[model samples]
Target: MRLTGTLDPVYNLRYVDSVNVSYYNNRLLPGGGRITVSVPVHNNRFSAWVPPLPAGDRLVLRLRYPEMPDSAGRILDVGGVSLMTGDSIVELSIGKGTYNPRLKKFALKADVVTGEQNIARLAYLGAMRLRNNITDTLRKKLYEKTIDSMAYNTAMQKASELRDSIDRDFIIRHPSSLQSLNILETIIGRYLNKQGGWNASGNKRLTEIDNLLQALDRSLRDSEKAQHLITSLDRAREMKLIPFTGIMPDGSVFDVASLEGKVFLIDFWGSWCGWCRKSHPHLKELYEKYKDEGFEIIGIGEEFGTGKEQWDRFRKAIAADGITWPQILNDPARQDVVSDYMVQSFPSKFLIDRNGKVVLRVLGDSEGLLDAKLKELFGK
Candidate 1:
């Protein structure tokens, strides 16, 4: 597939070094795939030969503008711009796309390349429009104090359900498409919460999901990505802890078995999660108070991008937060633990008893559930 594009010089072409074209790979398993190929940009124009993508494959074309200044003059990498793929060649124009610095999101304008690309583009844009409209409405209501926090959350849930219906319709209509499989995976994640638990409606959703998968083309149904999705579904129903090993930030191996026979907490968090970092002080207090009482906390740091910068952020967050617990990093080289846990959100935790059984699993702090449970366990 030949991909050629021109960026509007207004985007400050000097900052953009290349364009990164990322596409779906069903074989990578567990987390789906984000295979990226970088094409160098010169004079605001760039071209590259991308491997042919299977039908229904999702594509995201993004600018590699390091530290590009936003409207607010804040320096940061812009969020990726999703693109529709054509069969042979694609030509895009980065027209007067708007950038919201506060949200760190950018939009792009692409020329009508082919019928396939147009259909995909419309579906993508429709979803985005739905999300943006709902978000804008909610923001207006909140700013005007028309609704309280509880009401806001409830409305957000409804908005999510609305979007899920749209995705469901798309998948049912395009079962054989690879994009259908990708959308199915996302819907599955939403059904399975951060703690690997699902609600009463989950059973029905799972059955429907299975039917959808079977309706897919035989080739896609038999693909590795489909198999991974099936495995995840099974795990959601009969959720059990997966014993694994990980590399610590200090280059040491940490085994889950090491914490056996102790009342411990498995915290899945990332430096980018504000709520996770905010809870550090409380966690520090709990650890220091319960360490001698056979209580332990193992942090599974799920860093974003791999490299010195991300590692540094992880370490810096640890130091700044004064966290002293044993931390296991889930980098590219070691994503097994995170993948095994099926962690969908930050600050997901499992409170295990001395018998190595998960007594309580919660996303976020769970409104002091951790503290109350710990108090009961250790009689603090």
Candidate 2:
């Protein structure tokens, strides 16, 4: 493959040794091999031949500039290169890249044009723009105040809408492209363990994901990455319908199915998690106010330390905090309780109605929303 790009005229190219190109088998994984080749530079333009790479490999190019002496100290510029490649002639320009003086690295911003159809490139670009925009908006909001459940839920809703829009517009346009498969894989991995937000219509969303997977090219659908995505969706669906059993802190057996006749909550938490502890008071109040009205909660503690010691400590802490709900301590050996619920993060919660159907699932405390939902389920 041929690599051609222009170097900044401000930097002397004499100190440059060779341009480095790195490729990873899977862009999702880290630690890949690198290939470096010396290229001739004449009048700020450089051309080099990259040894033929494997048919499908993600590429990254790096250019480090020479250090120059200044009044304050020595300054150096390193250009970060982002590129998309395919079996064809590729051209790139790098002049307006962002540079970090401390790390001496420059970040090059470029849209990659791969061997896939132009539609694939457009989809990738559009999706990336929406992702970055959502990230920036949330970052700014986070600086102003602590992120509460409402703010986080709202931001997540907006992001889900953006993702759905990208999928509907782009993936549908090029269902057979590898680019489309990659985009779908990303979305699948993101919500694999999450059941709420955009995934509120649990079974319907799972069905849609399955349909998309089936829509891919036969070869691509049978690939390892595709299989993994399919498996994740299946597991999430199965877990939603499965009833879990655990041992309470007091050595009593606790079965989730036993609480089928009441509106209940499955609170997955950890002692080490600050948010889990912070939410205890509100949960306690809700329990006390609604206990006689058939409101029940099953606290599932995700213990990381020795089971007995951690369980004892957690019991003491809950008592001290006035949490009188039934507590189920996780058995590290048999962790299906956590896995069945797809509890990736602490403070995960699921609200179930009298029929044992999940009404809501959220990562953090649902705050007033939980209270509101309980009231709706069992009127105060």
Highest lDDT among the candidates is held by which one?
A: 1
| Candidate 1: Cα lDDT at 352 | 80
Model 2 reaches what TM-score against the true structure? 0.51
Give the runs in model 2 whose Cα sits over 4 Å from its true position.
Answer: 1-98, 102-130, 137-208, 217-241, 250-252, 303-320, 329-335, 344-346
- Candidate 2 residue 316 Cα shift, in angstroms, is 6.6
lDDT string, candidate 2, 266-373, tens digits: 888877788998898889888888889888998987654444567777787777767777888766455456655546677888788887667676777568768778
Q: How does residue 43 of candidate 1 score in lDDT?
A: 87
lDDT string for model 1 (27-94, tens) is 23223336678989998899978776555455777777666556523223355656655457777766
lDDT (Cα, 0-100) at 18 in candidate 1: 91
Candidates in order: C-alpha RMSD to true structure: 6.1, 9.2
lDDT of each: 0.72, 0.65
Best by TM-score: 1
In model 2, the Cα lDDT at residue 13 comes to 38
